[model samples]
Target: MNPELKLVAARQGGVFSRAQAMAVGYTPEQIRERLTGGRWERIRHGQYAERADLSALDAWEQHIVRHRRAVHAAMNSMRPGSAVVSHHSALVLQGIPVWQVDLAEVQLTRTSGRGEVKAGVRHHQGRLSPADTTRVDGLTTTTIARAVVESAARTSFEAAVVSADAALRRPEVSAEDFRRLLAVTECWPGSPAIRSVLAFAVPLAESAGESRLRVLMRNEGLPPPVLQAAFNDAAGFVGRVDFYFPDHNTVVEFDGLKKYADGSREALIREKLREDRLRALGLEVVRVTWADLLQPARTATHIRQAFDRARRTRLAG
Candidate 1:
């Protein structure tokens, strides 16, 4: 809490190099005491993060706090231009969402093959143009578009779709941006995985759950559904459903965590009425939740049944 140390921490995103602590008039014993008392947490060899700084963050934010500290620590220890953060670490710096990626290692990239700067470091050797790299969080990182594709290439198809969907939904990253970045990486190794994800990624997927649902449908060979489809009655706009099949008059809704985690009674009542309106319009509605997504086969069966029912109703009418 010293004035100089506070200023130093502010300059470094609530992290301070050990030398900064010393130069700011803190003795070695003082630093040891702070660490012993949990006032400061060591973020790798030469960096420290204040306990107070991370107290308000959730689990993921806390991990990011540490991740950034690791980035800076490595940057400070290495020779200039030795490595630039990329892949998952770069995605984190660019504020892009990554699905099912290991966060334990600090990710860095060098155009020339080189050994790591520290322990727990993941090093990638790839050609990076200025268009593909940008500075974020005071460190060199891959641009959002590049990071999304690169990280996606290193993950499973489902995870890749989730990350790509998130990138597509970002206001700063347009469909064109994705295309440009994909074009830049077309000749790179392991790009086919990401190319496949980009081919199917939809911006209408507003959450990880919705992205997962879309991937789930695709993997099962189900007919693609129209996203954010609206249902209206004689009164007015009734509701905008998540996914709709015009071919079968079926509506598929993805019930995300927010639908239940923080859902109020008013929201629940409105949701029920919305469903009623859709059903009244003779559309077969199938709601897919996280649980249903986990049981992909079961969810597919439910959707298939809904499509069949809608077809039968259409024939009868």
Candidate 2:
């Protein structure tokens, strides 16, 4: 590990391109030797990082690596032109939830094409304002807000709603940012549909998990579930519960069955312990599982009964 390469790797947070290494005075052979020695890990064709403490490819990292690859491919495949990664690619990069499936197409906007070009990418060619683009990790990308708008245009009202909600909740993204992005993309191909979906989803994205229980509860006319609610006491901030009704001191937790690895018996014991704590506080607790959520009619009945019981208890006291 030469000082120059170490400095470059540190500056890049242990990720650098072959070109970046060359610029920093490391030969391709040197890079290869380091990789063979287990001193560096190759992330992509040209991207390398430190071998130790490598982060696994979670959902977010998958999106970023895909976006980075697409951008690099686009740069290589196209003529000399600047293209900002747009639409769903931007949404994924911004950590907005659009769907769970793989996006086979990389999206981008440049000035030379009419509709789409390339096999894996859906490219939209049009004039783009400078403000519509920003540099993220040294690659051009649509601003977070524009990506949300573009994503809404490509999906259904429900999907768009989810994207908008996620976008609003993002700390770096704001309504003002969306407004500015909207102003720039309004005259572009999919503006009208984009505008409609953006309006729909941004207000509804309060919860983090995309659980069917959430959808079932919403469809059944329950009040919107507060997301990731935390409990605080003598111990600095107790565990964060899934949903809580502060006014009634009633908590509803959505336990994904898949998370219960040891089996239902152990899960049952854990739930009893959690319930006992809440009961000690004089709080009512309701537990819902994936099965209950799938059966919406039964789920609604359970919720209504719980609400009724809580009301009776409070009134009687």
Best by lDDT: 1
TM-score of 1: 0.91
Q: Which run of 10 residues does model 2 get worst, by summed lDDT?
A: 202-211
Tell me the lDDT of model 2 at 166: 71
Residue 149's lDDT within candidate 2 is 74
Model 1: residues >4 Å from true position, as ranges? 52-65, 111-118
Per-candidate Cα lDDT values, in order, are 0.81, 0.66
Error in Å for residue 37 of model 2 = 20
User: Can you write out model 1's per-residue Cα lDDT over 183-262, one digit (the tens) per residue?
Assistant: 77788777798789889888888888889999999888899889998778998999888899899899998886575557
Model 2 C-alpha lDDT per residue in residues 81-191, reported as the tens digit of each score: 646678777666556666643465677887665676556767776566776777665456777777777776666555566667777777877778777767777786677
